[model samples]
Structure formats: C-alpha cells, structure tokens
Target chain A: MNLLPGFDDILAAAARIAPYASVTPVLRSAALDTLAGAELHFKCENLQRGGAFKFRGACNAVWSLDDGQAAHGVVTHSSGNHGNALALAAATRGIAAHVVVPEGAVRAKLAAIERAGAILHRCAPTQAAREATCAEVQRATGAELVHPYADTRVMAGQGTLALELLQQAPGLDALITPVGGGGLASGVAIAAHGIDPALDLFGAEPLGADDTAQSLARGTRVTTVVPDTICDGLRALVGERNLDALRTHRVEVITVSDTETIAAMQLLWSELKQVVEVSSATVLAAILKQPQRFAGRRVGVVLTGGNVDLQALPW
Target chain B: MNLLPGFDDILAAAARIAPYASVTPVLRSAALDTLAGAELHFKCENLQRGGAFKFRGACNAVWSLDDGQAAHGVVTHSSGNHGNALALAAATRGIAAHVVVPEGAVRAKLAAIERAGAILHRCAPTQAAREATCAEVQRATGAELVHPYADTRVMAGQGTLALELLQQAPGLDALITPVGGGGLASGVAIAAHGIDPALDLFGAEPLGADDTAQSLARGTRVTTVVPDTICDGLRALVGERNLDALRTHRVEVITVSDTETIAAMQLLWSELKQVVEVSSATVLAAILKQPQRFAGRRVGVVLTGGNVDLQALPW
Candidate 1:
C-alpha cells in the first residue's frame, strides 16, 4: 500500500515545485460572494502552467525524482489535464514524457498534450487498457510511472496549492475543492488541516460521479459508479490513498447535479469573468446548494482548471 | 470643449476610484510571449467590475460628483459595458442611474444594465437618437450626464489602469490598448507617458472600424466609416478630446482584420486560459502582425473586457 502524503511531504513538495509551477493569483468576485453569501477567495489554479492545478503535482512528481530516475523520463496514463501537465512538466526538466491516451478521448485535450511535447500512446478506452499501455511505455523507455492522482508524490505536490492559498488569503474558515480522483482534495486537506487543525474541509463532487460521497458514507472506497456529466475531468474513481486522506481529514463531500454545475459555470463566467471548466464549477455549485453550511464564512474555493472545449460549452 | 485629462488627473482618479474599482491583475503567458517574440504582460481589466474596464471610468464619474449632484443621480447613453458599469457604480453610492440604450441593442447587455439597478430608456439605434434620449432623461431627472469615453473624469478614471499596470509590471517598453472611443488608449497614454515619457504607445483598432487609423492618417478626426466587425465594443467614433490626447501622445494605430482578432482570441483562451472579449484580442493580433515593433521588448497589453455572448461566440 502506498503511504498517503502528509503535511511534511506537502511542505517539501511546495519547495520542490516552486521553480516549475506558477503561484497562480487568488481571484475574488464581489458578485459571486453576494450570491453565495460567503467570502469566496478563488485560488485560480485554472491559470496554472498547464491551465490546471495538475501542473503542481506533475511538476513536483517529475522533479522529485533523483538524477538517475529523472534520466529515464516519466510516463502517465491520462487523456485530460494530467497528460498535458506531465508533458509540460517533463519539458521543464528536459526529459521525455509518454502519455497513454485512451481511444475516443477529447481531440482538443490530446492536441494540447501533444503540443506540450508528450509522446502519445493510443490504447483501448478502459481502465485496464490504459494501465497496460502506460506500463508498456514505462517498460519500453525505463520511465518512472507518475500516476495522475493516486501517487504519493503527485498528492504531495497538489497540496502545495493549499500552502499558497493560505498565505495569500489568510484566516480562511473553510476550504473547498472539486473531488475527482481525490488528488487535489486529499492534498489540500493535509496542508490546510496541518496549518489550521480547525479549518473545515469540503469536497465538491458531481452527482453523476458521487463515488467519493458514497465511499465516505459507507466508510469504504466505492469504484462502481459510472460518471455521466459534462464535467469530463471528474470521472475518475477516488484513489485509495486519497480516500484515506479524506477520511483522516474528516472531509464532508457535497454532490451537485449536472444542471446545478452548468448554472454555476455560467455564473462563474459571467460574474468572475473566468473561463473555468465545468468540473471546477462543482465547488460553487455545492456552496450554492448548501448555503446554510457556508453562509458568512470565509471560504477558499480552488478552481481546479480552465481547459474547456469552447465550441461545446455545456450551457 | 472638455479639457483633456493629464497625468495629475490620473493620479487623483486613482485615489478617488481606489475604493470602488478593482486593481485588476497583470497576467503573463510564457507561450504567448514566445509566439510574439516579446515579453507580454496582460493587464486583466476583463476581470474588472462589470466584467470590463468601463467600470473604472464609470465609478470615477459617479463618485466625482458633489453630494447635491450625486443625489440627483447620473445618466449615460450606452448599451454596452459603460451602462452596466455606471449602474453598478451609482448603486455603490446609493444613487439612481438612468441608462439610455438604443433599440435592437443586445438583450443580454440591457438585462445586465437593469440587473445593476439602472433604469433603461430605449430609443432608435441611431447615435443621435441615443444622445437625444440621454439628454431628455437628464433634463427630466436633473441627473448629471456621464459620457462613456469623452468626459474628463471618465478618461482620468480609465487612466488608473495604467498606473496599476506600471506598478505591477515596471519597465514596460510599450503599452497597447484597443481604441474604441479612445478612452482607454488616451488615458493609458497619458498615465504611461507621465511615468515613462520614452515609452511607446500603440492602439489596436479593428479594420472594419478603422476610423481612429483614418483620422490619425488624415491629421483630423473622422467620424464616418460605419463599423462592421465582431468587435462590438470598439465601434464608437473616437471622442474629440480623446483624439487630441492620442495625437498629443503620438499614439500609433494598428488595425487588424476580424479574422486575425478571432484567431488571437482563441490563442488567448487556449494559452492564457482567460475569457477575453474579441476586441481585447486585437492588441495581441497587432503585436503578432508587427512583430518587429514589439520583438524582444516588454509590452503591456490591456484586455479591455469579457462580456462576450456565450451562445453567439465569434468562433
């Protein structure tokens, strides 16, 4: 079993990825605040190096390797933000990155990954198929596998965002992030809870992909639910170590419907004037749905990414 | 004739509007910088209140009034960002705002104005009809008229952006802003030159509405040439005082076709991960077209707005 990343790991990761990743600005929307009835300090990871907070993790994972390990390069199985992020991260260190993309994955996302200098390996659209292909690539090139969210290094790297957010907007009463494979949420939980033991941690998940929520309720990881939402970024099953972090941190999961998420996405675009992905909208949607839980509270909302298909906007 | 605002006015306006207007962030895109062969700093006024830099001018104009004048409220003839901005600004002071909007104006824009608490008065789409309706509304309500981009206070307010930009990204070799009615360009020129007299000033104008370019070439203001472009925010004729300021500052006008602007907009959306309006993209398009002028130089590009119609995107 992989050891879950602790706050110390997150601290080390912050320093390690400092040079490779961007300290994205914390944005605010008075209009959004008024609507949510909470002070929303948006940590704009959407403007991160690879257009997502995934860069922090990918960069940290890529750079954390020893000189010998780094020479072998990095390999990841992702057809989304992680693929592009790992590719960009690898380029920063002058190393090869092999992205195992499943068939019928988003063309735009694939193009973005390729643009970031990743060697693409096509595979059948299945969890097993993707892992097999990634394994094959890793073996072929003797590259170290960088699991998107499940790996300890990636989770520790993602936790760096919480450190920056706390410093940028101190005295946050609570924090929220979109929960996909639980990489960001689990990492943020470790960092935030370590600094402020009393700070409330919340995870926003799509109703269609409520695996995290169901898992927490049952006190066991559930990987059976198939996601059916516009938030393509949040379809992954919550990783075991990530779920362990959520349980340890006492994170409360809130699930929002696709309609609510889309509406919140529109509100974000119109009010905050930021092009956040549908997946990122879950945080705001959850807040809006559970006003009583967050009213008048100072909340740090993490906008995970802004890689969207403009022509195929959900609204 | 209205007196043109100077650097001193910009300084005063910066202090005056500091409480109301946001000091928008200066964003950087390494990818875009490489593409332009220049160091680009994007002053994100699109993230400003009312989703545009128009709020800076509108806020200043509304707040510059004496108590008695303020009690009477403010009025402006605009169906765009200025109208919504003025309404929001007036609301901040607990004063009424009357917006004279043209018939057949964008329904969404008008709705935004109304949502900001401005009473909308519709008239024919002609400029004369808009001015007449505004004048009539001012007379009836005893409200002070706030010209969108012509008035001294408005220009000074817009100039605040330059002050913030210079402070945020010091040592910019050149500055560029879209020239609509010349409010932003003229104000930026005044403020930037006041700080660094040797700094180059450039204006990005749509080829379809090349009135500013034509006027600059003819050595006189040209009010003709009906606009025909996707850049709806940049169709107005340049104000006389604004033109004088532009000429006084020796501002160079760069006109780009709609195609180039739209393509640049895509690049901004993809690379910068920001939702900027088509008009704002003209600056990047201009820099890309005239690479020799900006190559290896630090250029401050102002993204003027982010109020594009989601369903009716140009792309």
Candidate 2:
C-alpha cells in the first residue's frame, strides 16, 4: 500500500508539472465564510486543466514516462474529467491516449475527450469489466497504464496541489475535498499533515455513496455496486490503497445528502457566479449541514472539478 | 449628449474610486483562443465587486460626492448588479442608498441589495416607471441621482476598467463587449482607441433586443420596451450620450442570437470553468460566430459580469 516514498514523490511531481499546470488562485468566500462562521478558502481546482484537478495527476503521469515508453502511449478509464485530462496531457506531450469509457457516459464528456484528441474505447458498466477492458487495451496497444488514483505516480502528482495550497494559504484549520476513490483526499491529508500535523483532513461524501463512511466504521475496505448520487464524479468505491491512507492518516469523513449538495451548488452559483460541478458542492454542503463542526475555523476545500455537463445539470 | 468629457473624467473617477474597485485579473483561455482562432485575453470584470463591472461606476459615483451630498445619500434604478453595487458602495462610504428596483427582478438580486443595506423602493416593471419612481425617491430624500448610465461620473468610472485593461493587456487588435446602455462599451472604445488609435472596438448586442445595433445603423439613439433576450443584462438601449460616443468612435456593433449566447456561455463553463452571465457571453458568441474577423488577431473581450442566477441557467 506504500504508493509514495516519503515526501520525495510529491516534490518530484511538483517540479515536473511546474510549467504545465496552473497554480490556481485560492479564493476566499466572504458570504460563505460569514454564513458558515468559518473563513473558507477555496482551492479552485475547478479551474484546472480539463476544468478539474484530475489534470494534475494525469499530466504528471503522462509526462513521467521515458521517451521510449511514451512513444507506445498511455491508457486510462474515466467517465469524464480524467479521460479529458489524460487526453489533454497526452496531446500536450504529443503522445497517444486510449480512454475506456462506459457506454452511455455523458455524450458531452465523450466528445470532450475526443476533442482533446484521445482515442475512445467503449466498455461495460461494471468496474470489473472496465478494469478488464483497460487491461486488454494496455496489453494490446503496448500503452502504459496510469490508474486514476491507485497508482503511486498519480497519488504523488495529486499531493502537489495540497503542497501548493499549504505554501500559499498557510495555517488552514482544515483541508476538505469530495472523496470517490480517495486519491485527492489522501493527497490532501498527507501533504497538509506532513506540513503541519494539526491540520484536520476531512472528506465530504455523498450520503448515497457512503461506502467510505460505512467502511471506516467497519474497519475494512468495502465495495458498493449501486450508488444513487447525483454527484457523478464521486461514484467510485474506496480502493484498498486510498482506504489505507485514510486510516493511517485518521481522516475525518463527512456525508452530505444529494439535496444538500444541490442546494450548496445553487448557492455557489448565485453568490460566486461560478458554476462548479456537484462534487465541488459537497464541501459546502457538508459545512452547511453541520456548521458546528467547521464553525469559526480557517477551512480549506478543493473545488474538485467543473466537468459536469451544463445541459445535464441535475437542478 | 457629452455626459463625460474626454479621458479626464475617467482619470478623475479612477482616482476617486481607486481604493474601492478590484483590479480584476486578465485571464488567458488557451482553448477559447483556438476556438475563436485568435489570441483571446479576457478582462475578467465578472470577478469585480458586486460580481460585475457596473460596481466600478456605482462605487465611484457613490463615493465621489461632497460631504454634504454624501450625507443626503444616493438613489438609483436597477434590476440587479447596479443595485447591489450602489448599496455596497454607499454602505462603504457611510451613506444611505435607496434602490428603485422594478417588480419581478430576480429574488436573489433583491436579497443581495437588501443585504448590502439599501432601502428598497419597488417600482413598476418599465424603464419609464422605474425612472419616475427613482426621481420621486430622489426628491423626497434629497438623494443624489445615480443613473445606471447617462451620467458623467458613472461613465468616467466605467472607463477606468478599459484603462486598466489597456494597461494590463496592451496592444490588442480589437476590443469587444456586450453593449447594453453602452456605458462599458463607450468607455472601452475611448480607452482602447485613446491608448492605441488603431485599436478596433466592437459591440455585441442580442439580436432579440438590439436597439444599439439599430441606433448605430440609424445614427440616432433608440429605446426598447420590455425587449426579449436571454441576456437580461443587455436589454437597456444605448443612451443618447453613449450612442453619440459609439458613432463618434466608429465602433462596430454585432448582434447575436440567444442560442449563440447560451452556446458560448456553455463553452466557457466547459472549457474555462468560468460561469459568466449571458451578457458577458455575447463577446464570445460574436467571436465564435465570426471567426473570419477574429482569426489570427490579438483580441480582448470584457467578461462583463458573473451574476447569473445559477439555479436557473438559461441553458
């Protein structure tokens, strides 16, 4: 389960991706801060490449390969942001990319990946099927497999964001993000805690997809087949490596209802005029649902992504 | 029709409101640049106070009055951004702000103005009615009239943005914006052409409510009554003074459809992750629809505002 060797991986990723990724602004929400009784600093990863933070890892993973390995290409399976991100990173490096997307994935997302110059391959709905198909493609095409979160390189790359955040907005009382497979949350916890052990790490999860919450209580990594959350970006079950990181780091997991997430999303749009994806709303929803937990603290939340289909906004 | 005299007025206004308005970021959109076939630089006034560039003028006007006039306070007729801007500005300067808002204005906008501590003066849903009511409020309270446009101070204040834009991203091939009352567009044309005589200026108007287009073509000012357009912020006619400025400056006016505006807005949301109002989308719509004109050019567009009702995005 040791994905990263000390903090060296985080440092390496930071150096490698320095020229490519945007060091997005850490925005303070006066209205949200006043309402929540906490000073909320938003690390606006929604403004990241492919309109999501997924780009950081995707970019690093794509760029890390040696020229000989890169010539063979890279592959991943993602519903939206990751696919678009990998496609963009691959395009940036002039390398080939193969994305395994489930059938009936949002057409806009599929088109976006294609528009970014990725070769798309359709797979079955189930995770097992997706992994199998991705494996087959990787073997057949001789492309390097870059798992979205579970890979060491990807986790290392993702942790660089938290490193940047801590360096930029020091003394944050808490670091929070929406957790699906836990790559981002794990990164945040490691980076933030490594910088300062007092920094609290929290994961805002959809109540419908509360496997992480249940698994933490059960003291084991668990899987769920059917997740009924509108936050499509947060649909994955906690992987073994991420779940281990969560336990070792003692991450606090908060669950928010879909209704609350939509409410927070609507509020963000009205107040900030930034149309963030539902997953981004999860942090605000968690704070709104239980203000006492975050009240009067310097809270930092990663606006996970803005890759939601505008035509398909659930609200 | 000379409401504001040359660049002197804008310079003075800039000095007056120097401490209030935010020097918003000029963002570069790589994807949008490719789509428009131009080097696109966005003057992100969408991130300004009150979430629109209107705040600059409102803040200046509210703060520039003499001590006696400040005590008497300020009054204005606006449906949204202007009201909030004036209210916030007045509050900052320790003055009363009476806002005459037409009936059926977005509830969120009304709430925002109220939160900023403005006295609400609800009026009938018509420009004439709103103005009459605003006059009544002004007379009764002896409040200084702060017309949304058609005022010397406001125009000068609005011009400051263009001055900043020119300074920040100088040597633009052209400057474009969604023209409503023409306050912003007029100021931009003045600053852009003033700084660089060869800088081209263009105005984007909604086809459904294109009084500016007609006015420019006819060489006279025109007015519209409850004109229909998804760009709710661009329904105002080009005022007499602003029309004269546009004509004198030889600014090109282009009209775009609501469908095009929505598509442009969605494109920014998907690619740039910026939730701009429909009014701001006009510039993008214009550039996208007429790529031949913008291709290979260094173009600058004002992202005029970001205060759209996210709960009810027109898309």
Candidate 3:
C-alpha cells in the first residue's frame, strides 16, 4: 500500500525549499470580508517566486533528488504554471528541465516557461499526446519524470503553503484551495488537519470541471468529461494518489459556475487590486456562493496563481 | 518663507496616522531587477488602506484637528484617490468628509469615493469650479480645509512612506516617486535625505505634464500650462509649499513620454502582477529610461496607488 505524506514531510519540505520558494504574504481586504461575512486571509501565492504555488512543489521535487538522480535533471508535462515553475526550480539547481507543452497552450504562458530556461517539446493538445511526448523526451534525455501533482515530494512542497499560512494567520477556522489535479488542496488538507484536526478543509472547483467534487461524492476518482471552463490551469484529471490523500483526509469539495467565477474575479480585481487568473477565483466564488459555510469565521483562501495573458483578459 | 517639514514632523505624522494607515509591504522582482540592472524595492502603497498612500496624509490631517475643528470635520477638492483617502480617513475618526468632485470625473473613481462614505459635492469640470465648491462646502459646514498636497501636515504625513521604505530596505542609493502636485515627491525627498544625506532623490513626470520639471529649471512654481496626460491623477500644478520642500532637498526631476509610460505600465502589470494606474508606472519608466544613473545600485520605487477603471483598461 502507498503511504500518504505526513505533516513531518511538509515540515521537511518547508525547510528544503526555504531558499527557493517565497514565503508569500497573507493579505486581508476589509471589502472582501464585508462581502463574505467572514474575515478572509488570502495567501498570495500569485506573488510566489514563479508567480504561483507550483514553484513550491517544483522546488521541493527538484531539490529532493539524490546527487546521481539530480545529474539526470527533471521532466514534467504542463502547459502553464507548473512548466514555468519546474523550469525555474531546475535553473536554481543548475540542472536541465524538459517541459512537454501541448500545441494549444497559451502563447504568453509558453513564452514565460521558455524564459525560465526550459527546453519545450511541443505535442498535440491532448493528455495522451502530452504524456507520450514527455515520456519519449524523458527516455531520450535520461531525465527523471516528476509527475506534476501525483508525486509525494510535490504534494509535500505544496503543503508548505499551508504551513506558512497557518504560521502567518494561526487559528484559522477553515482553509480553501482550488482543486484541479488535487495537488494543492490535498497538501493543504494534510498540513491544516495535521496542525488542527478540527480545522475544516475545502476544495473549490469549476462546475464545468467538477471531477474532484464528483469523485468525493462517488468515493472514487472520475476522469471522463473534458473541462469546459476558462480556468485553463484546472483542466487536468485528478491523480490517483491525490484522490487517495483527499479522500483519506475527508476534504469537502465545492464547485462554482463559470459565471459566478467571473463575477468573483471582477470583485477580487476591484477589491484587492491584484491581477489573478480565472483559476484562482474559484475559492472566492465558493465562499460567496455559500456564505453560511464561512460566515463569521476566519477563512484562509489560497490564491493559486497569477500567470495571466494581459491581452486576452476574460473581463 | 514657508519652511519645509523636517524629520521630526514626519515622525509625528507616522505616530499620529499609525492606527489608520497601513505599513505596506516592500516587494522585489528578480526578472525586473535583471532587466533594470538594479535591485528595486517597491513600497506597495497600492495595497495600503483605501488603496493608496494618500491615506497617510489624509489620516494624519484628519486626526490632527482640535476638538472644535474635529467636530466640524474636513473638506477637500479631489476627483480621485485623494477624495477616497480623505473619506476613509474621516470615517475612521467618526467625522464627516466633504469631497468636492468635478462633473465628468471617472465613474469608477467617483463611485469609490462615494462608497468610502464621503458627502460628494458635484461641480463643473474646471479647477475654479471645484475650488469654489470646496470653499462653499467648508464655509457652510465650518470644516477645515486640507489642500491635497500643499498643507504642511499633508506633506509630513506623505513623508511617512519614505520613513517606512528606508526602514524596510536600508542602504538604498536612490529613491524614485512620481511627481504630481508634488506631495509624495516632496515628502519622500525630506524623509530619504533626512535618513541618509547621500541618498539620491528623483521626481518622475510625464512629458505632457512636466510642470514640476519646468518649475525646478525656472527656480519657481509653474502653474499656467494646460496639463495633458493619460495620468489623470497627476495633472495638478505643483503646490508652492511642495516646491519649497523639493527645492530645499535638491530633487532631480525626470520626464518620460506617455508612450514610454504606457510601455512601463504593461511591464509592471506583466512583471509585478498588480493592477496599478498609469500614474504609478512613471517611476519604473524613469528607471528604465536612465539606465546608467541607476544601474547596479539599490533603488526604492514607491508605487503610489492602484485605483484604476477595470472597464477602461489602457492596454
């Protein structure tokens, strides 16, 4: 049986990635609080080293490698934030990073990943094609496959965000994170629950891609429907290990429609004065949708990322 | 002779406004540093209470009132950030704020001021009309007049930004702030020079509205030219007291074209991942324009505010 990462692993990851990953600030907006009927603490991972929480996971995975394995470098299949994060993390370690990006990935995102010094191997815009391309490149280059959300080390790295958040604003009644492949939410659940067993953990997802919510309801991972949301970063199927972690922790999953997500995004932009992608807006949408769930409580909302194409803004 | 505010006044203002204003974070960008060939520390007043550093001055001015004046409240003529700042500051002190806003002011900005709970007095879209309305409101209400950038207390309050910046990032070789009516720049000059006499101070301005630059060259305040710039927040002519402060500190004035300012705004949005108005981008434009003067040095750039119209994004 595969064992899930414990709080000890999160502590170790926090120490391991301290030099690379940013201890992002916990910001408060009074306007946001009034709207939600809750005191909200936002962990601004959008201001993280690679402009996302993915940098924490990527950095931990890159640095955790043994010397022999390190020399071989790291490889991943990501069209956006994760690709840029892994590339940046690898550059810090002075190791090669091979990112397999699909053909229809946003050009701005592709440029950012390339700028971080990743060798891009383009494939057709499909999961099978991306995986096939990544596997072939790994074989050709002898690079170690660092699965974006499934790997234990990446989950531990993502968990460090919770560690920092709790330290920044301790005694949070609950925590909310966007669930795509379930990496961030899974890690957050582990860390927050480990610190305070009674602390409620929630996963926010787009209604169009409610696989995680559906999986939690069905007691199994579901990967049939194609995502149809503007949150491009949340199009991946939930990994088996990630599902195991979420289920074991009893994480409550909630989904918000794209219309609600867009409205929440506008409110965030107007209220918080920050530029966040549509993916990061899901948690706020969830809070606004069910105010009773979070009202009068201190809720921690993890802003997953801020790598956006300015020219193609959704608003 | 109008004596410029000293370090002690800034200290007093800091102490007075501590409860109302925010000690905003100083952020850094590695990519931006590499591009500018300088280590840049951005004092993000855009994240401050009411979303601007104007709150510092307004808060200081509001609380400095004696019992009779406090009972009567305060009044100002502003169509943007200052109006919002004063309204919020007055609310904190449990007093009325009369903001004389000109007709045809940006709808979003006017809405923000109103939401902050200011009693908005509308007037013709002209400086004389605005001043006349403000005077009438003050006379009718027995309210104290707080000129946006001209008053000694306001200048001292604005100087608190420099005090915080210096404390946050010590040993800076230079500091840059956009020059509008000269409140922020004048205040920054006094605070920075007071801390380290050797530190360089620069005032950034748009080529279209280069009144401060012209005033510095002519050794007097210039107020005749029709201001024309995309920076709506920076069209005001330099105040006499602000000019005295700037002249006393020997501030170097630099001007960048509106085109260059827009490019810098884009770069800031892409690199910094924050929604800042065009007025706030001039400092970065100045840094990028004069590379040799600032290359390889530590520089502090004050992001003055982040109030922007989402529906009318310049890009």
Candidate 4:
C-alpha cells in the first residue's frame, strides 16, 4: 500500500461521502477578484453539511470502518468543526460518538455537538488533558479513535474537496487552502497535484499559528509555539503525516498576521456576502499579500467553515 | 399594454437581464424547514448583483430603454438597493445614473452607490423633498425616472426571479416574499400565478409597517402610516401598481413583529449560514408564526437582500 493518501484514496473517499456530504457550490466575487488581481473560484465548504469541510473526513471515517469496528463506534478529541462534524456523521450511521471536549471550548459549539447526539467527555483545556480524556473514553467504550487531522483516512476524506473543486472549476492555475492541522492543505496538495502536476498548491497560515510554515521552512515538524490567533479553527500544530504530505507534494505555506486575516474576513463578508470564519479568510489574505504571484491567474480558494458567534462579530 | 405586467413581460425581462443579473441559486436548510414545518426552497436574491433582487429590475429598465432614452440614462430616488442597482446597471450600459439619496440614509449604502458610479443628489429625509430632488435631476440629465416598485417595467423585471425559482424547484405548493415597496411581491405573485394558477402566494410585512397588510384587508391602498420597523427596506407603503397586482392576484399579506423578524434573521444566519438583512427574514417569520398554513408543503421563499450595517447588527 502507498504510504501517503493516493489519488485513488480521495476518489474513493469522494464516492463514500457523496450520499452524506454536500457538494457545496463554487462562489465568485468580481470585487474580490479586483482586490487580489486574480480570478478566484471559492469552493464554499462553509455551506457543507455541518457548516464546514470537516464533514467530508468525518463522514468518510465513520463509514469506512469494518463491521466489527463499526459496532464499537467512534470517538475524537476536538472542540471545533471536527467534533461537530464527527457527531453528525456518527448520528447518520446510528453509532455512538464520544467527543472529548476540552474545558473553555465555545459553549455554542459544544451545544451543537451535543445536539448532534455526541456524548461529551469534558477535561481540562490543556492538550494533555484532552488526550488523556479521549484515551480513557476510548478504553472504557472500546471506541475507535479518529484523530481530527492525523489519520490517513481523515486526510483522504479531506482531499475529496479538491476532487470536487477541480471538477467544478477546471483549469485552475493554483489552489489555496488555510492550513490548520494541515489535513485539508495536505489532502488538497496531494490530490490537486495528482490530478494536475502543473497546478501550484498553497497553504495559508496565521502568523500567530505559523507552525506549518515553520515546519516547511525547517524541513521538520515544529510544535513548540503557543498559538495566539483569532482564527480558532487553525490553531492546531501541523500533524506529522500532514507535514510529510506537504513536503512531498511541495506545498508552500504562507503566513499572514491576525489583523490581515480579520481584514480579509471582513472583505469576504462585505464584498463576497459570504459568512466565512476567520480561518477560511486566511486563504484570501495570503493571496492578497502576494498578489503579483497570482495576478491574472485562475485561483481556487477553499472556504473551510461558517460557524461564528453572532453576538461577537470580529468586525 | 395590460394594466399589470403580463407573463410575456416577465419572460422578456428574464432574457433581457440574463447577462446582467444572476439566476440566483435556490438554497435549502433542513433545520429551518423543521422550524417552519415545511420544506422551503429559498431563492437567494441576496446573492444577486448589488446584493439584492432590485438589480434585476434596475438592469432590465436600464437595458430596455430606446436609443434616445438610453442616451439620457436612468434616474431613481432610492437610498438603498434600487439606487446602487441602477448605478451598476447604468455603468454596464456606459450611461449616466443620477440617484437622489436622502440625508439620513445609511452611509455604507451611500458609499456603495457612489462606488457603483451613480451621481448622488442628496435631499432632505422627507418624501416630497426626495421626489422634488429626483425630478430636478431627471430634468437636468434628461434621465428616465424608474420608480422603485411602481413602474410596470421594474415589476416585470422583478418577476423574473419567480420564473427562475419555479424552474429551479418544480411543483412548488406556494411562494412567499417580503413586501416593502411591493415590487418583488407584486412581480412574484404575477409570475408565479401566471405559471401555476393554483399556487398560493403570500407576502410578509413587519407589524410596525403593515400598510400592505391593511391595503390587502381594507381593499384599498393605505399610505398614511408612520412606519417603525427595523426592516429599513420594507418601510415603504404599497405602491399603486403593486397594490393592483397584489389585489388582482389575491396575495395575502401577513404581519410579523420586529422581535419575530429578528429571531428569524438569527435562525437563518445560524442554520443556513446566510447573511441576509432583517427584511428578508420576514418571510420565514410569517411561516413560523403560521406553521399550520404552510405545514407539510413545499414553499418558495425569496431572500430579498444581504446589505446590513455590520456595526449595528440586531442580534
């Protein structure tokens, strides 16, 4: 078997997740294009099932299990889109989902996960506590652990977005996605490159959470910095498999400041009329930061999610 | 010519505005459907040019003019979507657009209109002053006056949305739209009924500005109310032609409270991941308030616009 998730894995994942996930629409904004000096085709994953592209991976993982593995159900430690996506995906399969949510997680997000039938296991906000809680829950329930962005299956599922996006907007010169745990970026880089070798793949990172950029620059996974970005969805460190995929596929990770990300987020909201989270806006931020590189080209941007606090708007 | 816009007018408008206006997508949200106890197919006009369905009418009017009329350009006294839409439409035709904006109108909206290439003529915040200013601009520029909702051509253009929505979602049981100047509702009622005589059409109005409801009830246009609603777009009294169409088509206008409209707007933003203005939420508010009337049926809803002041969000 191939070490990295091959093109076939993404194709299979696309087929597996078809009945469960949404084939979200591709959106365009002339105003935004003028700002970046590039024609952008935004894959609106914010409109995906559970309001994020995370559903694709979660759906794939929940349905890919063998009969015995399925009977035990699935569990994950997450406090954002991945947890909610997994809960909803498990609900569709009528399987138990245990979400190990760290303390101080957004109450609205946790409520949404619970609403999707996930049994919440709370722990201290630290990563160690989250891992310990997830492990304990896994041991007690004999549940299959599905890491948010580390597993090959999950990465393959995330790559399905590129498959759909490439089909929707053919002849895209470059593809840009915000890197979180690097699952989406790695998956996109692998699948997009596999489909068209000439396509330039880019990963956007917040300066406050620039481990992915740091790792790529150092040629090693970096995980020492404490993230301090408004893009809550992209605060996770780059996963080992994700870093490997990025390196192998030659994906360039560009970093932008939180202020720039927020400005891009407002531009997307005001100009595109799209309700995307700050993390998703980072892709556009990266494009604007180096407009000369993408000028007059057809660029594809992945809008990762649209879950935001209504009362507390960043603008 | 017929007293009201005919089916052929809508068809012609559809073709006329196709190049300029978007055939806005029909979106669905299961959570919103469950809340209203009905399956709603939302015609997302909020995603239309100038961020509202008003663009369809404006584009049609601007393009429909003869050589002499087109040379003179188009003029309107709108402090909102119609003004911006007309400006953009005129820009497309390489003609001048003179917009008469009131003093107290939204600063962001005014800036957008200016950016769209409309020559702004500011007037007092009263009706007589606005009309006087509009007439003066029209006289000076020899521009054709396009009433926001009263003109037959404008109404015909707005009807094109219904034509598109019906084709997108075949066999709809009913259709609903928020009534402000009555242009959208009048056009929708005419087009929807022309397509399917049996289809029920409903209009939503905020109680604070229930002139349309009163007009439909008392069988005569009511134009003497001091409007007081958060839906700035829907505060205008029913127009003469709009009242005629609404009466002829037998459209029912349902009144909702500001509280209800706000709640529905929040629900739409949270569940549908759509950033629509409060005016657009009135349709869902009406459905939720009278679920029994629409339960277990497929309804087409027109989301009017997405232009709202982010700094002063109702939520």
Predictions' DockQ, in order: 0.65, 0.68, 0.75, 0.68
Listed per model in order, the count of residue pairs whose N, CA or C atoms clash below 3 Å is: 0, 0, 0, 0
Q: Fnat of candidate 1, please?
A: 0.53
Please give, for residues A1-315, the per-residue lDDT of candidate 1 as tens digits.
Answer: 167888899999999998888899999998899999999999999899988999999998999899899999999999999999999999999999999999999888898899899999999999899989988887799999999898889999999999999999999999999999999999999999989999999999999999999999999989789888778899989999899999999999999999999999988887787888999999999999999999999999999999887778786
Q: Which scores higher on DockQ, 1 or 4?
A: 4
DockQ winner:
3
Docking quality level of the chain pair in candidate 2: medium
Give the fraction of reference interface contacts each candidate recovers: 0.53, 0.82, 0.61, 0.50
**Candidate 1 pairs with clashing backbones:** none
Task: Quote model 4's TM-score.
Answer: 0.98
List the candidates ranked by DockQ, beginning with the highest: 3, 4, 2, 1
Candidate 2: clashing pairs of residues: none
i-RMS for every candidate (Å) is: 1.3, 1.5, 0.9, 1.1
Question: Model 3's lDDT to the true fold?
Answer: 0.89
Model 3 misplaced regions, further than 4 Å? A1-3, B1-3
Please report how far candidate 2 places residue A228 from its true position, in Å. 3.0
Q: Pick the candidate with the highest lDDT.
A: 1
lDDT for each residue of candidate 2 in B1-315, tens digit (9 for 90 to 100): 246547877787888888888888777777888878899888888778778898888887887799998999999988678888899899889899999998898887898899999999998898699889988987899999988888777777888888898888877888888899888888777766767888888999999888988887777766654579978888887788888888888998888999999999988777777768888999999998888888899988889888876557785
lDDT score, candidate 1, position B315: 76
